[model samples]
Structures are given as C-alpha cells and as structure tokens.
Target: DVKVTQSSRYLVKRTGEKVFLECVQDMDHENMFWYRQDPGLGLRLIYFSYDVKMKEKGDIPEGYSVSREKKERFSLILESASTNQTSMYLCASSLYSGRRYEQYFGPGTRLTVT
Candidate 1:
C-alpha cells in the first residue's frame, strides 16, 4: 500500500518562529510537492522536488523552502511563521509519468500561526 505520513497533524507556532513540516512516502516516488490549502485559495503549490537534492520553486515559494535530501522524505520549511501563513499544508508524491500522474497525498498538517 502506498502511504504518505506527515510529522504532525496539527501545529501551532508564534509569529517569526521557524517551522518545519516533515513528510515521508513509502512508495519511493520521484516527485514530491508541498501545497498550502486555504479557505478559498484552494491548493497553492509551495515547492516541489523531482530528484534527491534537486528542488524547484512552485507558484507560492516566497516565504517557504523545501528539502529533499532523501528519496523517501521531503521537508517543508517556513523561514518565519506569520499569521497569514497559517493554513493546512498538504504533501503529495507522484511518479514521473508525463501527462498521466496520480498524486498520493498525506493526511495534512494544519498549522496555526499566532
């Protein structure tokens, strides 16, 4: 069974504090993505990594960064947490099959920044 697990299901952080969100996939997918889900904004991509140690900036990567040092793990880092950054973070992994790919998403991490 393919599974993606997040480090925390819920997190609370103070403004300006650094936060780390960890995600691990047992399927050994090559493509990993970090997305933030808001009330109306839906899912906005924050970052993605296609290969180990290779990262790419997504649609909204200004205040966030990602690390994929290992093939099965991906970490999303919030440089400085802010109230506006509070949202449900989702981690997904997919194969490199062009045009037809299905992403397996984690349960998600709901972060609240105060």
Candidate 2:
C-alpha cells in the first residue's frame, strides 16, 4: 500500500505566472523525486526520474522543470513564477532496491508567489 498523489495541496501564483505541479505513484516505483523546502535551505532536489523517458537533475535545478511520461507519472514545472520561487513542494517515490531506498511522500505543495 504505497501511494503518493499530489496535484495540489495549496498554490498561489502571480509573479510571471506559469506553474504546474503534479505527481502520482501507485507503488510501481522506479524512482521519482522533485523537492523544494526552504526554512534553512533544507531538502532541495529539483528533479529526478529513473525510467520512462529518463531524467535526472537534482540540487535546485534552477527555475525547475521535470516530466516523466509514464511509470506512475511525475510532473513539476514552474518556469516563470517567481518570488524566489516560494517553497515547500515535495513529491517522492522510490524502489531502487539495491541497498538503501525508502522514499514515499506526497502531501506537500505549498507554493506562494506574489
């Protein structure tokens, strides 16, 4: 029973406008992650994808952009919305299964830019 689905929990954009955050994982995980959390510059991993079209770019990833065609779905893009790119946006799902892999979280999407 591993589920991570987040289309939006809360989002308010104004500056520049162009924001889309969506994530869904029904356990068929291969590895998918997109994170952003401020407060001390804590968890900051912008994009990740293990299969389905393939993608990898973590550690901020600038303005942010990501999309996984299938494999449960994962999309996060905010090309213009500024205000230092308001924080708290996280979506993760993992099943690497090599040594250490335990990530399942998607109850976040706070974004507020004005």
Full-model lDDT, candidate 1: 0.95
Q: What is the C-alpha lDDT of each candidate?
A: 0.95, 0.90
lDDT tens readout by residue for model 2, 1-114: 798989989999999988999999998999999999999778989889988879999977988788888999999998889999988899999988776488999999999999
| lDDT per residue as tens, model 1, 1-114 | 789999999999999999999999998799999999999899999999999999999999999988999999999999999999989999999988666499999999999999
Candidate of highest lDDT: 1
- C-alpha positional error of residue 70 in candidate 2 after TM-score superposition, expressed in Å: 22
Checking candidate 1 for backbone clashes, the offending pairs are none
Clashes of each: 0, 0
Q: Show the lowest summed lDDT stretch of 10 residues, model 2.
A: 93-102
RMSD of 2: 11.7
